[model samples]
Target: MFHISYTVEGTWRLLKRQGWSWQQPARRAIERDDSAVEVWKKETWPRVRAVRRSATPGSSLRMKPDSR
Candidate 1:
């Protein structure tokens, strides 16, 4: 028989800031024969404490310069 569990943290954008970051947490469970076992998992992403808005007044931050 075998069992495992784990936890992970970080933001999608900040994690991707360095490179192409597309991460998903690893799944864990127990393996056994004729055994009764229970499993549970929870995923939580903390809200962005400091969500950024436009860089300047009356300007769009996500807009590209070449598009204007």
Candidate 2:
């Protein structure tokens, strides 16, 4: 076990010298579902793109009103 007194960079270098490589830990949410994400990408994304492409130039959906 490495001591906390060592700097992060120094510890990384020491590990590398001993033939160990650093790996990033996954930061995914605990409740995330891969199938649900895939379904959204395949189904919902295409419908959203179609609506955006079919919108007219003068339509309210395509225009942002002045904030001032």
Candidate 3:
């Protein structure tokens, strides 16, 4: 067992010398469901695309600048 006080830089150097490195955990939740995502892609996406494509004449899904 070793007990020593070190500044931030000194601590970082010590960790490097001891074969340690920084790491980041995954950004997503572990409980996320895969089957639900596939169902949405296959079932919901086509309906959404159809609605967007069925716009009226001279009108669009995008926001247009008001000419008034």
Candidate 4:
């Protein structure tokens, strides 16, 4: 019983790390929180990829701004 519980908890933690959204619309969890999580994602996600690219060395090529 203990081993089963431990395994289940470990799997859930791993899934959480993999971006499993408990606040998914189908889960009804986001509604109770007044959709704060969803709204935050809307405001935050836009720059995530850009920020990552800026942080990576040689991730982008420097070209003349007007280069076709």
Model 3 TM-score, 2 decimals: 0.33
| Candidate 1 least-lDDT 10 residues | 37-46
**Overall lDDT per candidate, in order of appearance:** 0.50, 0.83, 0.84, 0.66
Question: Which candidate ranks first by TM-score, i.e. highest?
Answer: 2
Q: For residues 1-68, could you state the per-residue lDDT of candidate 2 as single tens digits?
A: 67457788998999999999977867988889999999999999988884445555664575787699
Which regions of candidate 1 deviate over 4 angstroms?
A: 1-10, 24-68
Candidate 2 least-lDDT 10 residues: 50-59
Q: Compute the lDDT for candidate 2.
A: 0.83
Over 12-35, each residue of candidate 4 has an lDDT whose tens digit, in order, gives 898899988466455664437657
State the RMSD for candidate 2.
Answer: 13.3
Q: Model 2: what TM-score?
A: 0.34
Q: Which segments of model 4 are wrong by more than 4 Å?
A: 1-6, 22-68
Q: Candidate 1: deviation at residue 46, Å?
A: 25
Task: Evaluate model 1: give its TM-score.
Answer: 0.17
Report how far off residue 2 is in candidate 4 (Å): 22
* Residue pairs clashing, model 3: none
Cα deviation of 7, candidate 1, in Å: 20
Candidate 3 lDDT over 17-51, as tens digits, reads: 99999978758778879999899999998888854
